[model samples]
Target: MSIPKTMKALVAYSATEYKYEPDYPTPQCGPDDIIIKTEGCGVCAGDLKCQHGAAMFWGDETQPSWVEPPFIPGHEFVGIIAEIGENVTGYKIGERVAADQIVPCGECRFCKDGHYWMCQPHQIFGFFSGLNGGMAEYVRLPKKAVIHKVPLEMPLNDGLLIEPYACSKHCVDRAKIEVEDIVVISGAGTLGLGMVTYAKLRSPKKLIVLDMMDERLEKAKEFGADLVWNPSKVNVTEEIMKLTDGYGCDVYIEATGHPSSVVQGMQMIRKLGRFVEFSVFGEPTTLDWSIIGDRKELDVLGSHLSPYCYPFVIENIANKTLKTNGIVSKSFAIEDWESAFDAATGKYRDFKVAIKF
Candidate 1:
């Protein structure tokens, strides 16, 4: 394949400003690097929140902005290898692949401790200038970037799901669910649906899902959720208590990113239960600290990006065990990125929206 000198991409100029260039210079790969011609790139909620001026992304009075301008803005992408550097041994040109979103500084203390996901000077691809993301026709995978070959049999849209699915696996791992445990997943969105798919593999006592969308809740039932709830139709907490016989759920995974869901999770989780928070909230959420400490004695776990779970995710996708049916609601061309972004931002209530090259 002939590599082009320039390609189309979306570059960030500010929290709310993005430049859609039709012919931006393509990224160059180093000796140990590789390049992929994007097949699909899913627009995540974080991208939308960052663009809408979320303080955590834009930085406010007391914090520094995490996302700098002039960087591409799509992390959940899958592509075919267009170029491979001289020393890149495992990959070949024309292979399908997905790159881990975060590129850690190998010398950092966390990386040295085998927790690369916690590296202090994290340079996430697509957000930082040094590691540009896949919201383009082509993306460069640097030496430090973790790359995994995606099986060709998987649909491109399904393959683009690796990143978020991997994160869901991490969240499930954090919960440490037991076969006898009652698990409740809040939010039947993509991440929550991903959780339901994998959580069922553990064979928990009961798998309950909550969402306001009846359609998503129905999908959850099909994905192996033992029970599904619509907060709009019933008092979720009250119904949960009835289902659990007033004991409350043993494991509560919060993926709604809604402030009320946080409070609801705190109230519905049993004493000494595990509460795994996996959502990237659009704004600060305030809740009573007493429930976490003195009141319930619950174990609160915060889940970040997918770490050490990529291989498992890859295997699931290859095996068709991750439930990709109807997951990708829409795919748009690079020129229609604005519509794609809007659809992905929940303007259309789609499961996932991606840009296809």
Candidate 2:
């Protein structure tokens, strides 16, 4: 097969914030690199946060790769290899795979110690200093970071959800949510809903989801949440405590990043219980230390992009343990990115947003 001289893509230009246009040239790859013709890409909330210059997108503009004005926005996508670079091993043209959006340099002390996820100089596919993402038609994958033999195909239009499921796997593992333990997930948005679905894998004593939107609340119950607690109507913390026999919850997963929810999260944790701050809050929020004072012993933890959760999520999806057919409400073509972005902002209980090419 002959390598095409140019391919179509979406590019971001400098000036204002990153904006998408109809077509940009597909990137070329060198040794140890591969290019994938995108099949689908998931619109991440972080992308929206990055666009408006939130804390989510860090690094200096002077250092370069600082959104670079006109860069593509997408870290989550699945596709087949379109081109392979010289010396790239273990991957064949036309193979189905998911490339690691972020690859930590192996030389880092943290990486050499088996904590590769924390590699000091991390290489990310979609966002960050260098390299392109999947929001466009083609993505370049470094040789060492390509994930193969993973299930990236779904009946035509559904494959875009694989990445979100990968995130769920990590949350479930880090949350340490035990079966028969009362778990309260304080957001029914995409990430919250994914966490809720993952929380149900174990037959917990009770699973409650808190969100302002009744539509999302309903979707939460549909996705296996034992109950829906709307802070708008009921006292969320008190209701959760009441459900746990008034002692409080064994686990609290805050996915909203909303300050009010964060404050409520500090209050919802039981004495000696675990509180996982998993939300991608766009702005800063204040939490009172007194919430964890005296009586309550809390394990406050944070989970960034799930690094060790790919295979598990893939297996579960293969075994029918994870259901994509349920929470996936809509998919938009990358051309309609404006609507796609709008849909990501807690609109109508969409557990996940998929973009098809």
Candidate 3:
């Protein structure tokens, strides 16, 4: 009953226009909604894409129409329950939690099929469709978004990584990667590195990471990549072929969404190999159709978001299997959000960054 009328948040709708203001109002709590006092939030690479006018808008193309501007945008967040709606009875006050940004309509066809990630009217929060993101003092979520009880074994601040972890887990699941399968990742940023870490758990016979940047390539090696390739310095295809004895990787996970990388990803695979496009592409890129569809008989795939990856991330963390806290190299406050974005996606940086609330 005592929620504040307005609070400060980072609001953006155009590339040249992002502002920090105190005008976001806590929404009227629906029966199933809970308010969260955000503790930490990440600035995903997709967040940077929105700023540079690459994110697609269903009806608006001229403007960088990400989420409705004037709305906060850090959906990758973790927090404590600040207020619970009358009908929300499961969560305790101050209970620690993280949530899914991709909120689904439970009655949709995909939801009926138990694939909520592909729901037709998929309402992603902190985008343009729903409440202010966690870049503020508090945020509200429907019970559907809440995934409670990350193990207390690891620092709760790292729980902001659950969303990104979900992405890698989905990729692993889709590829159906087998033990001893040779895997190659075509980017070593957070998502790519997450893939390296998680894919290794399946006991792959070989794992390699490819990147144009040496910093990322080195980071991949630190994460247990059997080999790391810098395309700037070596012929990636030749190296991969040599590693697999002219066979090819059983799986190629494309995490950068770069066109050139896609080309390499396809070429890096053996006949009948699977390539999961895990990155967010800025725009359409040309692919060699003859090679992609004809010769190689490749099984190219595109995974959007995770289905049930939250708990696994927590488990990985609790069990000391995955490293999220150490992967983050910088932190920025809500007021210094632009720098945080640049820091995370900036060319010289090789780590993830977050806006701590």
Candidate 4:
């Protein structure tokens, strides 16, 4: 496929406004960079939070803006390599690939210590670090970008989910579910369902899923959740305690990014249990400190983005180990990004929404 001189892309000018630029310049590959022809880009919750004018994304008085606008806004994406840089090795043009959402500065203290995920100067794709995102017809992966070769035969639609699934795998690993443990995952959204999938692989005695939406709970059940609960309809804390013989669940994972879920996890997790917090909440959540340190003595773990799990995510999706059918509810062309954004943030709870190039 021939590369174009200019391409259409959604250029976010501010937290609330985005302009569709028909003449957006297609990226040129640097000596160590690679250019990918965008085929699919998932609208992440981070994108939605920024679009909704979250102060955490846009700056307030105390904090600087995390997601500066005036750049393309997509990170969870997959595509065919259109060009490879001269100094770039280990990859070739025409290969399918997914770049890690983050591009670490590599000179930071964390990078030097091999914890690149905590790199001081973090430049995430689509979040305004001068590197444009995959919402366009083409996107450039910088030299510092971590790239994973995706199997060409993997379902094109599911390809966009590679990032989230990897993140889920990492979160479940943090939970460290024991064979006879009772695990509860709060929220049955994409990542929550992913936890259900990966946690089931551990052969935990019971895997319970809690979501406010009945539809999402049903999907969790289909994803091999031993039990699904609609927290809106039941006193989920009491229900979990009863199911676990008043000991509470052995592990609780909070994935809804809701403040209430944090409190719920604290209440439902047993003494000495593991609590994994994986969501990026829109607001701050206050919880009792004693619950974590004194009363329960729970082992609290925080899960950030996918680290060192991309290969497993790729192989699982390619091998059909992860279910993909009905996951991406719909796909829209670049020209129809308005509809795509609408679907992503709409009342309809889609497992995933993609902008197809």
Q: Best candidate, TM-score-wise?
A: 1
lDDT of 1 by residue, 104-221 (tens): 8899899999999988888888887777888999999888888888888887878878998998999999999999999999998888888899999999999999998999999999
* Top lDDT hit: 1
Model 1 lDDT-worst window of ten: 49-58
Could you give the C-alpha RMSD of every candidate to the true structure, in order shown? 1.1, 2.7, 2.4, 1.3
How far is 116's C-alpha from truth in model 1 (Å)? 0.7
Q: CA lDDT, every prediction? A: 0.89, 0.72, 0.77, 0.88
Sorted on TM-score, best first, the list reads 1, 4, 3, 2
Listed in order, each prediction's TM-score against the native is 0.97, 0.90, 0.92, 0.97
Residues 295-348 of candidate 2 have per-residue lDDT tens digits of 686888787766867766666666767655556677887778778777876565
Please provide, for model 3 over 48-159, each residue's C-alpha lDDT reduced to its tens digit, 9 standing for 90 to 100.
7766656473225565443665557777888877788788777877687888768778888898898898878766766663656777778888867746566545575567
lDDT of 1: 0.89
lDDT of 4 at 259: 97
How many backbone collisions does model 3 have?
1
Residue 202 deviation, candidate 4, in Å? 1.2
